[model samples]
Target: MKNLLSLLTIAFLSTGVFAQTTWKADKAHSQVSFGITHMTISEVEGLFNEFDATIEASEEDFSDAKYTVEIEVPSIDTGVEMRDNHLRNADFFDAEKYPKMTFVSTSSEKVGEGKYKVTGDLTFHGVTRPVTLDVWHRGTVKDQKGNLISGFAISGEVKRSDFNLGPDFPEAVLSDKVVIDVDAEFKKA
Candidate 1:
């Protein structure tokens, strides 16, 4: 009985130590942006200004990192206010019905030095799809408050039609594929 208790104590301590390295998103320093082909020659780009993410990363190695991110769809901004307003309508994001989109990590593995492949379930427009992002660690530093800060950039592409945003635009003007970029900073929590 004493041996079993000792083992349990060690296990609990190890879990606590592992969790201490977690970092939460610094919303002011992070942004999620997306771009889609418009007219096959031009691109339309937009960004979500309000979002949050939680990251668990190892200071010694980035492969042990994990992330979960949430984005507010209504916060999207394009260069033109009219275009941005249109995108928030039912024809596009339908922010009134689905105010947010989320991505939760399923797996994270290192592909090369400071580079990784992160697989997750991405939910958008009430549909969920498994997606993979090419992630790169931009390094870590100390903030003004002396908290550890880490930066990462990830990119992926998803088919907009898969999420039921298919019939909104004419096929000639819009493509189904949309590319997403995530540039995030995390502070040790």
Candidate 2:
């Protein structure tokens, strides 16, 4: 009887230990981009070439998942070399002062199939604010190399005013709204 009890205890302990899975971002197959109004009529898009993310979740649905992502500020690219350099200086992102920006999930809710409303604190320009991202799980599959892969598409918006970037730029030229989009893939680790 004691041996049976010991077996049961070990089973439960191992179940808890193995329930959580970790996924590492596949940066080569992922992208993070942003868009904002350039002249109130045209949109200017930018991409961050370097970023990292990790996802941790229980074996069940990802309703309780935890997400963390960091983007290197110096990697900002807007397709124009001159403009990119100008934006990287202290007048804009001040990449030297704030080398990285990050987003960490505080809560997540599964609203529908493969969709989630994730609320998190976005820290940028040395400031932090709450943002809710619309996240969609693009499904999971196995690669030819026999590796598990998962994809996600995330979208959200933030007010530049909330992050100390609004007052620095003239409203007529650069709006206070910034849209973030991330289409990323992760490999099971």
Candidate 3:
């Protein structure tokens, strides 16, 4: 009976030591994109070609997730070289001054079934502001290679004027609100 108690104690202690879990971006299957209204009539879409994100926690309750994401500002692509170049200047994203836009989650709440309201501060163009993202946890699956993968659909909006990244004529030339979306997949790391 003493031996049995000793073995059980060891097993319990070992489980705690190995309980930490980390999720890393599966970049090839993840994407970050944004859209903004143009001329009060049309919309312009773009994407960041380079980004990295991660989810870390003791368990799979993403409401307790430690989330961080970084996006390369210069990687913004609108499928037009000239437009992309123009956006990288001081008048816009100013990739030279702020090479990356980042989001580090401060808190999360389970707002509904399979949905979470993630509140975080987004830093962009030398400015930082609080933003809330509506995140939907798609599901988790184990692949043929035995790697566990999880998916999330996230969307949020930021005011360009708040970050001093807007055109002078925000109402006439472009809208103040920019909508961001991410279809992200992460693998157990």
Superposed on all Cα atoms, model 3 deviates from the true structure by an RMSD in Å of 2.3
Tens-digit lDDT track of model 2 for 1-189: 999999999999889966888999999999999999977899999999999999999844567789999999999999999989988887888899999999999999899998999999999888999999999998889999999898999999999888886466886899888999999999989
- For candidate 1, write residues 36-124 as lDDT tens digits: 88988899998999888998764456687777888988899987899888888998889999998999998888899889999999998
- The models' CA-based lDDT, in order, is 0.86, 0.91, 0.91
Query: TM-score for all predictions?
Result: 0.87, 0.92, 0.91
Please give the distance, in angstroms, between residue 163's alpha carbon in candidate 1 and its true position after superposition: 1.0
- Candidates by TM-score, descending order: 2, 3, 1
Q: Which residue segments of model 3 deviate by more than 4 Å?
A: 1-18
Could you give me the TM-score of model 3 versus the true structure? 0.91
The best candidate by TM-score is 2
Mind giving the per-residue lDDT tens digits that candidate 3 earns over 1-189?
999999999999888965778899999999999999999999999999999999987756576787899999999999999999989998798899899999999988899977999999999998999999999989899989999999999999988988999566556898999999999999999
* Candidates 1 and 2, the one with greater TM-score: 2
Relative to the unseen true structure, what is the C-alpha lDDT of residue 100 in candidate 1, on a scale of 0 to 100? 89
Error of 2 at 155 (Å): 0.3
